[model samples]
Target: MIYLDHNATTPVDPRVVEVMLPLFTDQFANPASKHGPGREVTRIVERARREVATLAGARARDVVFTSGATEAANLAIGGALAAAGPDRPRVLVGATEHPAVLGAADAAAAAAAGPGTRAERIAVHPDGTIDVDDLRRLLGPDVALVAVMAANNETGAVNDLRPLVEPVHSAGALLFSDVTQALGRIPVSLERTGVDVAVASAHKLYGPKGVGALVASGDAWARIAPRAHGGGQERGRRAGTLNTAGIAGFGAAARIAAASMTDDGRRQRTLVAQLTELLVGQLGRGAVELNGPVRARLPNTVNLRFVGAGADDVQACLPQVAVSAGSACSGGGDVPSHVLLAMGRTAAEARESLRFSLGRATTPEEIRTAADQVARAVQRVRSLTQSTPIQDEVRDDNRARTARPAGTPA
Candidate 1:
């Protein structure tokens, strides 16, 4: 199978696995222990911390390790709201945010103590990028946090977060970003971008699953309360025994990404363009419409709308190509993509959209094969749906019904 779903998760790099192997067997001591082995393990963890921090443009002390981006998002949103107290009970999140961020904001708003406390969605442009004007209009002193992701998972829309920093800070609210999709695929410096709190997962960057970090500034960290409490790990921002092996692997992955990201992005962007051009050449430009922004998009990602073909039906027709109808978190469900809908697409149009995210290992040959397969699958689905006599009959009946006067007999 040709895997094109790197936005969902990436295969763990062998080098990262190589670094993690010894931690599970020979160096299996708790970092919290006072013994020599434990102290040595602690050093290893600290080194990994520094590596991840460097990639994120954050201080090592500011990184809080978590189980994954979901947990980290919850911790950051919940902690930010908690620290702000009841006075600042409102949360403003981007309309196209990940489920984790939306859910965390919803939960916080639901649990809030005041009457007017709630979570509101900031609007997005038709290209799926956050509307800075809409965000500025929504900002207020009552808003405790603003969550605008660095890049959208489904549409690969990259937001210019620097445009939002001043407005958000002026309103006395913290700016949090879910950078899970952008961290390794693009250059992201939270400190330079003025993002107060950001969440990222290792699995998105060729590291092991179940390891992510909440990178925050010193001020942002002070505003966040610990969600888990027991061992006072992660400098009291998070509490639990560290996943030593996974942490080591995460560090190695970061180091590798920092070194090779430029080359990887350049290569993947070319391949993605090749894939798009091939599909459009075969399917025709009208039949295949690009869903995300033509510019300011992720180098390895593209979302396309196969006109007149349901995404699910097309996927069913192409069993070998591993593409996604939407975010993996919401995949396998009948619901249309919220991200696409937020970008001014109708429910049917959203249902017709599919996301193609490439990875470091994707090749030109694979791209060609996948594009040919996708073109065939889309054609098959469209023909099956548009040529059926039953569908024609249904369309005729619908047109007749509409033409008839209201309340008239059938």
Candidate 2:
């Protein structure tokens, strides 16, 4: 199987696996305890924390481990808003934000402002980057926080945070960047960017799942209340026993990603360019619009909109070739992509996008195989799908067509 959905999640690196295997049994101790075994786990967890912090160019004390990026995002958004105090605080988020950030902002606003405090969805440009001017207009006395992703997960567009951050700070509104996509894959430093809070996940960087970190430099955690109140872990911001194994794995993964980011990026771009060339050559012009600007996207991600084929049909047809429509959180639910909708794509166009996210293990040959499969599957789905809803995608039926190549699998 040619797996291409690295954006959704990635296989644990063999090294990460090696690091985690002993923790499951040998390092069996609650990190919260003070015993020798517990202290040993705590020491390892701190090393992981420092490594994660280093990747973000953040101080080690600023990092707090969580179950995953989702939890970190929630704590950042909800916690920041709750700490904002009274006044029916305003919460703003980018249109293309992941559900975790959006939902966190929603919950906080709902609690603070009753039902009507819906977050203002700042409009992102067609290329999937945010407009700082729009954000300036949206910022106000009531606005408590602004949430924007560092690099969009679906479109891979890197948000130019420098401009956005200045406006947000000038407005006295704190900004939280869900840098899960940017942290290890791109050059991100909290010191350089000056974002108030940033969230990152382990699995996204080839670490074990169930672990992520939130980095905050100042008293950013003061206003945010805990979603759960129990143990005094995470500097009393988050309450729970830490996932020692997951944190250890996360730190290890981040270190690897930091060291190899440049190399990985070059390889991914080469493969992406090769595959996109094949797609454009095989599929006619206007048959595809690369979802995000090729130049601005994350090197590892490629979101291709098959103009005349069902995303589900394309995905279903490529059984051994694994990819995703949008976020993996949409388990079994075939909803139109919110990211594409934000990009001004029609429902059909949104339904047509397929994400191919490369990873450390991806190769030139793998990309060619995936590209060939994609071309064939798109063509097959367009020809065979009997549904009238999809027929509208046909640009010109009168155009000459060729039969599927003999080598394509049944």
Candidate 3:
């Protein structure tokens, strides 16, 4: 299959795998152990921490490894809320945030409720960009944290976070960003942006899954409480045995991403543009609507809505191409995309949308083939709808059967 769902997850890079192989075999000793083998393993883990910190533009000391972005996000939100005392109990989250952020914010609020503690959702513009003005209106001294993503997983919309730093800091609130989709695709400097807390998964950047990091500033860490307790691992912020192999791969991926992101992004942007143009050209501009900003988006991502065609049905018709109607984390539900709905799309329009995310491994030939196949599938589905509305046909058949006399045949 032609994979175009890099926003969901990427195939592990072979170079990253090569670096991790030795750790799983000869160097399998636990980092926490106090032996010669353990000291060597501990050294490797610290090196990986530095590599990850470099990518995130954070200090090595502030990097805390976790299972993945989901867990990192939970620890960041929950820990911050827990430490925020009863005076500052409000948490503001973006409307188009990933499920991890939304769910974590809800759980954190529920777990840390006081008299007025709650989680509020910030709104987004029609172009899928966060509404900074709306966020300013929502900010207050009582707000402890603001959760916004650096880039949207579905639409690839990039947020201008610089404007938010002043407002959030002035209100005595911390800025937390979920940078899972933005880390490798774009230049995200947590230190430069003054982002207090940021989370990213290695799998999204061509590393192994089950490994990620929470990069928090010195002040941010001071405001967070430990979520897990055990052997005092991760400096007591996250308590668990480190996955040496996965962490090694994650560091390698970060190093590679740092070196090659410029070239990879340029090439992927060309491919994505070609694929998008091919579809819109074949289907006509009116029939296909772009969901996010034309610019200021990830070079490898695109979300499009095919008018009069259900995204599920279109996806079903194109079995050879791997794409998503929405986020993989949302599960296989018939519900409309919350991201699109929050961006002013109706439920029907949201159902008609699909996201195609390219990667470094994606080829021009694959783009050509995927475009042709997807365009044909959309046309076929639209034709079927025109010829016989499936719902109407089913209803008509039911009425005819009900009206027929029972057991009329002799």
**What TM-score, over all chains together, does every model reach?**
0.93, 0.92, 0.94
- Candidates ranked by lDDT, best first? 3, 1, 2
Candidate topping lDDT: 3
Model 1 stretches with alpha carbons more than 4 Å out: 385-410
Model 2, 22-110: lDDT tens per residue? Answer: 78899979988989999999899899988999999999998989999898888877777777666537889999999888887877777
Better of 2 and 3 by TM-score: 3
- Stretches of model 2 off by over 4 angstroms after superposition: 114-116, 385-410
RMSD of each: 8.6, 4.8, 6.5
lDDT of 1 by residue, 306-363 (tens): 9998888778766679999999996367899999999999999999999999999998
Q: Is candidate 1 or 2 superior in lDDT?
A: 1
State the weakest 10-residue window (summed lDDT) of model 1.
385-394
| Model 3 agreement with the true structure over 1-410: per-residue lDDT tens digits | 99999999999999999999999899999999999999999999999999989888889999999999999999999999989989899999999999999999999999986888899999999999999999999999999999989999999999999899999999999999999999978888999999999999999999999999999999899999999999999889999999999999999999999999999999999998999999999999999999999999999999999999989878877768999999999866899999999999999999999999999989999999999999988887787745676445545554776688999652
User: Given candidate 3, what's the lDDT at residue 24?
Assistant: 85
Off by over 4 Å in 3: 386-410
